[model samples]
Target: MIRFVFAALLSVAAATAQAEVDIQEVTSPGGINAWLVEDHEIPFLALEIRIEGGASLDLAGKRGAANLMTGLLEEGSGEMDARAFQTAREGLAASFGFDNYDDSFSVSARVLTENRDEALALLRAALIDPTFDDDAVERVRAQVLSIIASDEKNPNRIAGAAFDAAAFGDHPYGSSLNGTAESVAALTRDDLITAHRNVLTRDRVYVGAVGDITAQELGVVLDDLLGDLPQSDAPLPEDVPFGLAGGVTVVPFETPQSVAYFGHQGLKRDDEDFFAAYILNTILGGGSFESRLMTEVREKRGLTYGVYTYLVPKDHAEMVIGSVASGNDRIGEAIAVIRDEWARIASDGVTADELSAAKTYLTGAYPLRFDGNAPIADILVGMQMTGLPPDYVINRNDYVNAVTLDEINRVAGELLRPDDLHFVVVGQPAGVENTN
Candidate 1:
């Protein structure tokens, strides 16, 4: 019953947020900046923080330090042990999450306005004084190692790992942020501390706050929550151009089906033609059933259940990648069809009907993203990371709508590289030829 009420309220809030978002930029007394959206309809708030140079900040030979440190954040803090910390957070009905990605570390909080003070204090403790105690360290380390073990056996992971290794070389993006089993096992508590110091510094932080809070209140909240964090510029990974070329690298595994990951270089997020490329991809293989790859590979040939491509514009490098899974015997056909579509789109570009349909879908679907405070807060922080203006929430779909047919086709001509497409397949018993 309580859940139903909460869900209904969330639905209404989402509708309101979809209609309009008035984002205000706030600077705390301590000079920390944050983006805010106020909604006093409910006594709820969501705070999102992004610390740049996430796992990429892990020092030489300390590959998993940032990830390990992130995992240990909620495990314990200040004077409390892991269990005590969790109990206290639960008592205040607060939620805290910590995650590490290639370019940034994310911290999220959701709390009632009544408990905001208590919730934020606990969150601050987690950030400023995480206790990487022996017990917590071993526990989280074992969990990470277990994950590594599972990923090794997973065919999809195998294909992606091979794909990344081929594309990114020795850049941190080349390897799993989880690091190798050896690297993770060798990480000391001090390594985690160093990671915390390096990755969570104030110099590279981006913040977003949404729900029952004003700019003034959020200003105070920001200083209180993040002011004490060390102010140092963390070193970001150097940019490396996409290095993979067109070829097939087959890894032999005894399985009836093969999982393939493929792609080559991609454009940056700030590329002038990114919007055009986005729409073009939507018509090509943007995960929907309407995509050319899905229509050809699944409907016509019955080669795979799904095939899709995406633009991966990372902090340092960019990529246009796609994935598919099919019977080992038919994986060859899937790859051939995918490559043909790549060339077809690159050669002829999308039709006018396809462009119109893609624009409508893209524009129509944009508003549904603001489902609630947390999601909007997430979008706010993401915008900051990507250098988007606060008003982008209003004008984003306009950019997609503004892409002319000529513009997208021109991008297609320049962007899609059928000759340089790469495929990494994990499985045996196939008709596919190994090119590498």
Candidate 2:
């Protein structure tokens, strides 16, 4: 009987996984818009909200203010202090999260259908009425300082910081999200308040929702939660031109293994050849065990335990970046192999067999991401942020499969820059030297 029950549960899960989500574009009376997916199978709802201009909007000399402000959103609001706010959220069995990234501030919430109204009221309080109390600011400031201190000693963090500095110079993109200890220590309640005002504006907001809710109800909820935010007049950071020349930047440290962060200019998201470039990158390095980088660097040569690459399509800049760690003596050899593979892939694209395999795996794996409400909500919001069409969820894999070998090869030749790649090596390496 137990085995039979387990089998039945698996069948149900499979059916749920195969269910299609119907998306609706909702516009509130207050002129707010949201993408919504209604699913009554679950008695809960997931909402994701994004406000453009996150840490990048921090005022001059006040870096990390946005991050600190986001962290303090739920610390207190209206009549509720931090402890009282926690109790209220727990009483409704709901979850609320606020976070700040380089380009956006995000709020995520999950609440039972019956409790959604009360939960949204609480969310509204947090969003529009955050007190940014003195004690709360100081407490969160200390917490952020602790994190900044910890990152100072992290090798990956060091490499990333150096890479950003080299690539972006004095642009906001080059600055750390968590400002220096001195800058953070100097932050005041006024900075947090101004940062909040600059970030949470109606003009920069995108929202998505999933689960047991009607479009009409969602429209009302949207207005109630976000209707009062002021229109943002603050200017976002300007585009950062790629500045790091082809070279090695060595930051001496005392570690047996060296971590290197390397990258060059990348194609924009809206470029017509983006799909082709995406497929080409998969063949070169984006694919984990099956990629050329992983195969040559780890499997055959065994220079490193792991290596990976990704495309960063940010609002202001684009990049094709990657990282690897190996013994100090072997890192130079690994770097040489990486450069060789990069050039080879640029000169000759993937084989027909490889392209077919990439298509099959990518298409098959895409649907697995929408098996839950939160994941669906996330995809919806991301689509809006990247300016994707409402039907993108259904049509994304088609674009991937439609990429031709000729197109991939052309894109690879144009996009890959083996000579222009810059490496920030953070460790004591034997053979590598500063080439800049």
Candidate 3:
């Protein structure tokens, strides 16, 4: 009887060890869909907010409008001016900020559980009652304009802007997330307000929080904060597939080293071959010191300190991007090496050993990503943004394990075409051959 009890306890512990993380789907009394995870690991809490369909919905000729709107949100709201808002948050010992990137704008907050009530209250005020003060707008506009001027002088920035323009054309995603000199100057307070009203609605919003909080507490707190915003059932934009830009585009800079980007289109976020592509990319360039790109480009020739390739799949467009920096003289040769590796992978795919190492890396790194509430909150926000099922994280390892040599080769052939690459190079390399 004692032996049977021991065996039963062992089985229960094993089953618990492999159980999926319990992620709660919280609906705020105000009808907000948030992903919540309760963990008492620390005394602090992490809350992440994603306003879907970010800059892609910027209207024609209003290139910097969405970006500017997101910036002004926390600058001032309610009775608080920009300085007052800053002072209040600082005095309260709370952290709050918002920023916009290519795909989405996010606001993140980290505060002690003791301060949760006041912290979330202030956050809500900023989101719902932003004033878009005229003087503040002008000040921010000047700052943005100065930044744009600075970017024009940056070789890497020039190359990136040029590449996006060539690749995305008229797509909103192609436009600089930071407005151009002309567009930033043209934006007014009304433009910022309109853009904010259109995009930051409750229906498409996702809020995720983890650490010293319960699901019920979070639901109540977030409801008080975001419950009154207008609900939107806006339709997502249609997929815009990326195609190769026919020729090599070069932006000449007089610097000692050249920065280059090569590769064409890539897979979408929800592609069935997601794991397969993930594994293949690691073998190609995503791995740290072990990747093939680093071995050939850096280790073999001593050309670049680092080289990498990655995929970015947004609502409007998806792309495969590769970047390398090398001395101006060897930039051309470096580009050639990149193409050779590219072509080789396109034709032959990764070897069994390469494939095995990549799978191991992917699986091994999964747990490391969940070590903190902030990272866990980030993962939850990302899953909701991409429309992934809750169980996707639990099944992630199985997906990686399922990728076979045949599937890797098939995906490599279909997604990669070396000759069809759009290469962008910045700076001058003295000893390198020019293939453009």
Q: lDDT of candidate 3? A: 0.79
lDDT of 2 by residue, 1-436 (tens): 4334434433443456633568899999989999998978666788999999999998899999999999999899999999999989888877899999999999999877777899999999999999988888889999999999998898889999999988998888897988889889999898988999999999899999988899999999999999989899889999998899888999998889999999999988989999888887787889569999999999999999888888899999999999999999999999999999999988887788889988988888888888777778988999999989988878888899999888888888899989999999999999999998
What TM-score, computed on C-alpha atoms, does each candidate reach?
0.97, 0.96, 0.91
lDDT of each: 0.90, 0.89, 0.79
Candidates 1 and 3 compared: the better one by TM-score is 1
Better of 1 and 2 by lDDT: 1
Candidate 1: misplaced stretches above 4 Å? 1-17
Top candidate, metric TM-score = 1
Where does the lowest 10-residue lDDT sum fall in candidate 3? 10-19
Query: Please, what are the lDDT tens digits per residue for candidate 1 over residues 244-363?
Result: 889999999888899999998999999999999999989999978999999999999899989989999998999999999999888998999999999999999999999999999999
| Candidate closer to the true structure by lDDT (higher is better), 1 or 3 | 1
Candidate 3 lDDT over residue span 1-436, tens digit each: 4334434433432332222467889886666788888867455677898887677767678888878888787788899998988877765566776878766778888766666787777888888889998998998888888889999988878788877877777776666888788888998888887778767777777888877788778878777877776765445556666755534667778887888877788888899987788888889898478998999999999989999989778777777888899888788888888889988999988899999988888898886677566667888998998988888879989889999999999999998888788788888755443344
- Model 2 residue runs over 4 Å out of place are 1-15
RMSD list, candidates in order: 1.6, 3.5, 7.5
| Candidate 3 lDDT for residue 428 | 74
Clashing pairs in 3: 328-428, 328-429, 328-430, 329-429, 329-430, 329-431
